[model samples]
Target: MLVSTFHRCFVAVCILLLSACSTGYHGSFVERSFYQGDITGLNLLGPAQAEHCQSYALYLFPLKHSPSTQLAIKQAKRSQPNTVMLADISISDTTHWKIGYAKKCINVTADAYGKPPSTSNG
Candidate 1:
């Protein structure tokens, strides 16, 4: 009975270790914030300008550091985005908003979320 218990414990430990390692396969993405105020009073001159402005919020999510990142960057480079419209006049009192573009460097890691390893040789 003791031998069987020990074997079960050992298997459980191995499974936990393998599960931790498997998380390294996925990556993460970050979204930068933009406010409607900063981009107000700007003109977006194009045939599809109105449609682009309607979906502007979708552009806030940056590319993840994975295969998808390459594709997103390529698409962004090909299409230049223009700004249009301003914050609603009723909501102009808010000044704590931020608007800008951000570029993140790709980091390779052997752990999840590109976090550094917990164990170090030193």
Candidate 2:
């Protein structure tokens, strides 16, 4: 009887620990965050998105270093080779934590723009 009771208690503890895992999200947006030169010649290609993540071992030491907006932006730019700037940008940060490990990620979504094809409408 005592062995059965101990097994039940262990199961309860495991359930509680698993239920304690949590996740959080934060988001921000900007009109233009990655451009500076002339804007009159740029054409909106389309929407683009990318994600960058960093994992923590033992909930302390980083495994893939820290996630950053810069890395996310770089990843996003890869989808479109002609993308020279981003507009209507949105950045979302997510964090998930458990008993043994944690993860942080950055998701970047933006409208990619670049120079249009040169043509003479004359």
lDDT of every predicted structure (CA atoms): 0.32, 0.81
Model 1 RMSD, rounded to 1 decimal:
22.3
Best by TM-score: 2
For model 2, the run of ten residues with the poorest summed lDDT? 17-26
Off by over 4 Å in 1: 30-122
- Candidate 2 per-residue lDDT, tens place, 1-122, comes to 99999999999997777445433356889887567788888888888899898888886578956788998988887777688888888999877776888787899999988875568999
**Top lDDT model:** 2
Error of 1 at 68 (Å): 14
lDDT of 2 at 42: 89
